[model samples]
Target: MASMLKDLWNRFAGGGNASVHEEPAAEAVEYKGFRIRPAPYSAKGGFQTAGVIEKDFESGMKEYRFVRAETHPSKDEAATFSVTKGKQIIDEQGDRVFR
Candidate 1:
């Protein structure tokens, strides 16, 4: 009887375990109208990028425009660029715009 009770207790205690751990949700940062993924690297050896948001200037209507920059590590020194004009991509140069 004691052995049966111990077996029952162990079975209940270790019954079909599910996931032990779960992955954390991704972290994001927003700047202006862009949603930057993860966190921006430090300026020590990081590159900066820019994005623009506009409405439908292409079809002569209203729409949403979203642009993002490339991610750079904290060791490479290079320029990044992104451009958008009214839900349409324009030109990008060194993470800045030229008039």
Candidate 2:
């Protein structure tokens, strides 16, 4: 299957431990009844804008992760942009983003 091939490729390319570690996540920011955690990862000679937005629903906790094309020279700048983007997404889409 395609998944099997992808797994094989990952093992060969990533030494089979790609999922074991990750860049430490930034502290969560509470905003508009949601939690946004910036997680900038180094990429393409810079830090890439990334983050996770979460909310507690009656059903359960829901989360959405975003990675923008924007990159910054420093992790702090990337994280700042990530939070801003997360806020924009929440303001524009709200809970419908989890849909």
List residue ranges in candidate 2 displaced over 4 A: 1-24
Model 1, 1-99: lDDT tens per residue? 897455434433433221101111123223344332221223224432222233223445332223233435531221123221211342332223222
lDDT of 2 by residue, 1-99 (tens): 898567535533434543112453578899999999887766658876777888998999998867677889998998889899999999999999998
Q: Which pairs of residues clash in candidate 2, taking residues 3 or more apart in a chain or in different chains?
A: none
Assess each prediction's global lDDT (C-alpha) against the native: 0.29, 0.77
lDDT of 2: 0.77
> Candidate 1 at 65: error in angstroms?
6.4
TM-score of each: 0.19, 0.76
- Residue 91's lDDT within candidate 2 is 96
Model 1 weakest lDDT span, ten residues long: 17-26
